[model samples]
Target: MAFVSSERIIPISDGNGLEGGGAFLPITPTPNDVWNGWAHSGAWIIQNGFNGGGKDNVTSAPSQAAQNSVTVSDPVTQHTAADPVDVYTGAFLYDGPGLKVGNGEAPMALDYRPHYSTNWRLQNTAKIGYGWTHSYDIYATERHASDVDIHTASVAEIAPYWVTAQYLLDTVTKIPTAKEVALRVIAARWATRQVLKAKVTVALGERRIEFHRLSDGSYMSPSRFRVALEKSPEGVFTASFKHGNSIEFGGPNAHASKIVDQYGNECTFAYADDGLASVTDAYNRTLTFGYTLGALSSVTDSTGRSVTYSRGSTFDMVDADGGVLSFEMDTYGHQEILSVRDGLDRVVVVNLYDVFHRVWAQQPLGDALKPTYFGYAPGLAHETDAWENPSWTKFDSRGRRVQTVDMLGNVATWV
Candidate 1:
């Protein structure tokens, strides 16, 4: 049975992505390269604009809100003086990359990509309303990246595609591959006793949702996702995501000798008498890593630029450009990252966090002020945003949206 993969992506870093109490990395666009992009978890979510033939563009799970285009006379703020704004409540989306099984037809649909590749950068923000979207399955292989459009195919395209139906059905993946995972989605709209239980599609009716790392293959960083590593019998430290791909670290060597990705790509490490000495990601690429006084002194990534870390308690980095990316930690309690500062230490990138470590509010990239506030649904967005979180423009467990409150406190509901 081909299980359906619901699409959702929450940060593996406390499932909220506000590590180091800040957001945005000026030095590197993709900061999750340290763990090879395992910083976020793919979630199972509702499908709102999908399953329709030609009403929408399911070919690409765009996060753009229809409200952005439509102007509204309704006031945004709760007060009477508030003027009407052009933006409307956005839609809820299962935003990310993903894979799908064949449609339930005879020559079942083959691998289908719901979005763009990992390299494509997109934003999934919430202003008023939200929408449903899909993302990469953690275990989806290259086999899932077919650009075939079954929803709006031309007669010519469908004729040729149907002609090869026998070949498609004969070569479909029937079981889990080592590098792939079944999409076990939080299938329901509301919270059950299991707290928004997740369900997987099965027997040729399912989709395969995958999770992708947020790295641009850059140097390592001090900020790390608070995930545990599984020690292998071979003494390797393995970190695998829920229903996504995995990366392995720390081999027989006292230190992690290698960092290997799911596709077998790896960066091998070597150490000196003092500490780490060298790292070779490929035959042609070698980097120098060193430690001083038992602490990481300097590291040079493939960019050939070295960033030095202070020996002090703060995890700060001084890039070659003279800019500093600093993380302030709490002295007491859990000692979480208090805030993140840039080289100037003037404009704040990330400011606050909720108990769940989600972004309570933060400035958008480039814009230093006027932070976008965020409030989460009770359970995981994957499991219950449809019903529990009215911010999303999707139907819930009750098959209806109870009510919606915008950033301005405007309220709307479906009765």
Candidate 2:
């Protein structure tokens, strides 16, 4: 295999994309150092709550990824008079946690967002929230135009982290007299999109503030994780996260009014006809921002220490103490890539995103540098990582791993 070596982005600015860890630090740290959108590539995951892909009684199509279901009468009422049970046949095959009936729940119908996070890591960015992760992961949920609130439907996270999918169903239990069984059954959708109800979203990002409404009419949120999204009297949407921070959006033009934390900290930015604005934190320390249109010019901390940026055909950054960080770009075929250099002008980070391999085929400029492939493919049962080294895995038709081979050719077989 042709392995490629590369570097990771070590934020040259005191902002969001502070990913690659090294001996990097800003002149100072504060709130203004948090949400610099332009600090990294525009292609990164935004995690802005929901991604807008919901379906009513969705089914899979691809050969190995298909979730084949039969619409036979629900076993509970298949032979009786009460409205048919809502459950289907194949659902039982997937009822267990981390259990697989096929290759994966990855390539799912509800996972229609065409983003790399979803495709690569199988992460459902559509929500930053969830209810009873395990109990709800594979479950179907729905609501109708005339319904009072959105309720769980059935199909059936945190239980099975690697697998994620959610489907909407029009099936509303009649609660009529029917045969009692060990499992709950939810019928498939029989209506079209015109009348299909919208799905309620959960705001469950990893350790991020989580919010979910429970059946008893109470919210299952963190100690102070009350309202993730709420509607105002003016019909505007306001999202509040943990720590009393709030994001207000949807004004006259649908633009997001800058975020404000609990202590009343705000981003102080300047347009062109003005001097740099000062951003004061809850601690009273302030940072000054200067920009030169389309580029961030400099940032000065309250201590009067500054980090400056200069860009021409290439980019360069200098810290308060004269430490230098430089960035350059190159094109291979048609793809343009970025490279970062440290104070010594030594290459520390390289940008090489390979679309087809589904990963970055290069390792960083760390002490131990080597060509490596950190990516996965739907057809390939195994993957490699910058840490795990080169490994091979054999998967069945359903996408479940059957065998694995490490770079040393060590064999591991899974039945």
Query: Highest TM-score: which candidate?
Result: 2
Cα lDDT, model 1, residue 412: 54
Q: Encode model 2's per-residue lDDT on 302-341: one tens digit a residue.
A: 6667756676665566766788766553334321224557
What TM-score do all the candidates reach, one by one? 0.32, 0.38
Q: What's the C-alpha lDDT at position 406 in model 2? A: 55
Q: What TM-score does candidate 2 get on C-alpha atoms?
A: 0.38
Model 2 misplaced regions, further than 4 Å: 1-227, 248-278, 331-337, 355-359, 366-369, 379-388, 391-415
Report the error of model 1 at residue 330, Å. 2.4
**Tens-digit per-residue lDDT, 1-415, candidate 1:** 0111332332222222211112211222223222111111122211242222122221323233413333344322211101110011111111222222333211122121222111111211110011111211111121121333566333332443353454445445778454333221111211121111111111111122221211121111112222333445664444443333353444422333444444555555565676446655533354455566655456554555665667356656676676776655445433334455677875344434344333334443325344443333321121112122223222233223333434332445443
